[model samples]
Target chain A: MRRARDPFFWGLFSGGGMLTALLLPALFLVTAITAPMGWFGMTGYEEWATLAGHPLTRAGLLLVAFLAFFHAAHRFRYTLYDGLQLYHLDALISIVTYGVAAVLTVLAAALLILVV
Target chain B: MKSQARIPTGRISDPGYPRASNPEYTRHHPRWYRRRMPIFWWLRKLAYTKFILRELTSQPVMYVTLFLLGKMWVLSRGPEAYETFIQWLSHPALLAFHALVLAGLLFHTVTWLNLTPKALVLRVAGRKIPGWAIVGAHYGAWLGLSGAIFWILAGR
Candidate 1:
């Protein structure tokens, strides 16, 4: 019997989904919503830079960004296949979706590495 | 269009063949017709629409991640580049875009967290933990993480 390789992508999708759900909301609340609205004291650029400079922070950011991108890719691929009824384009869709995610993941890694 | 093919029956003299079996069985099976899925099917039901919207939320999540990456890129270029990126973030249009993305992210978070218990079945000792307990544990972890981030940012 031939084994399908879907489980690998599904595993990444599930892990990414878990992390995104766990982390994104609060991250957004502080960084996007309240901080922008000045509810909490405005975070200075230097302070943010300082935080971003930490190795642990960079590693955490990389993990969050990488998983989240893969999650989006997997979800969007299914969405296109099922929602748009583009099963005929399945192979192309998979290639484009995961391909873009891989590129973005590399870009994210580079950016995180360079953050100082 | 449908095509039909007939099966040839083997002679009873053939070895290893069941002699009691009928010479041939004629079966008429209609071609399967798949129901056409409407493009806007999700819009027809509130639940489906919500589900689709939740899936759609991932787009904004991806965009925000890209934006963060861009921010990091700018930060790497030095304070001037970083200042420009921050100023760009403050633009009215960008701020409005972030507001919509924020709503989408929050929706994604709530629905994702609500569904966590269903995905993770936890058994303590010989007994299964209640669904609400699992949900509460997730929310507790969320709160703890959020509190830690806040403390790190503001407690200094």
Candidate 2:
């Protein structure tokens, strides 16, 4: 019998879901909404650079990006498969979804490494 | 579409098989139709529409992650590049898009947290914990975290 890898991806799905649920709302509000709208006082170059360049902050951001990618991949796979009834293209859907997630995660890591 | 193709016989020898391969069996049986799911199946039901929308919230989550990754990459290119990227983030068009993204994230958070009790069935000793307790705890933690983030980002 072939061993199904369902649980592994499901783990990523749930982990990503929870993290994104808890963090993304506030994070987006501050960074993308309030700050961008000039609601949050802009600290400008030195402060922003230091924050992004910090090892701990970079690590945290990378982790969030990695899990969020897989979380999106897993959920979107079923959204395509069942929601759209694209089950006939099951193998193709899984590959494209997870493949994109993995590639993006690697890209995030690379960018984080250069954040200095 | 043979009339007897879908009928089952008790004998093992007459078990279900492909109609094309067993032409003799299909000759006396009707083809069993595979009910194809409609592309707009979600539109037919409110429950399904909500499910799809919940699933789709991942897109904005992924988008925000990518945007941050881009921000990080820009930072690596020095203050000039970083300033330009921040300027782009403040663009009215981009800000408007992010506002929609924020709505999606909030929806995802509320839905996910509400569903947490069902996903996690907690038991204390012999008795199961109440659903509202589980839900309240989740909301409590969410508020704590969100408050901390706001303080760090916007507090004096």
Q: Which candidate number has the best lDDT?
A: 2
lDDT of 2 by residue, A1-116 (tens): 11157989888888999988999898878776776566766546666667778899899998999899999998889888877877689899889999999998888887787535
Give lDDT tens digits, candidate 2, residues B1-156.
687765755445554545444556544558779987778888888998998899899899998888777766776788888777778888889888888999999989999999998889988898999999999999999999999888876664
| Residue-by-residue lDDT tens digits, candidate 1, B11-90 | 56544244324544335556679999889998999998997898888797897787666666666677787666666767
Give model 2 RMSD, 1 decimal: 6.2
**True interface contacts retained by model 2:** 0.72
TM-score of 1: 0.83
Report the Cα lDDT for candidate 1: 0.77
lDDT of 2 at A86: 76
- Reference contacts preserved by each model: 0.47, 0.72
Stretches off by above 4 angstroms in model 2 are A1-5, B1-31
Q: In model 1, which regions exceed 4 Å deviation?
A: A1-5, A36-38, B1-31, B154-156
Q: Report the CAPRI category for model 1.
A: medium
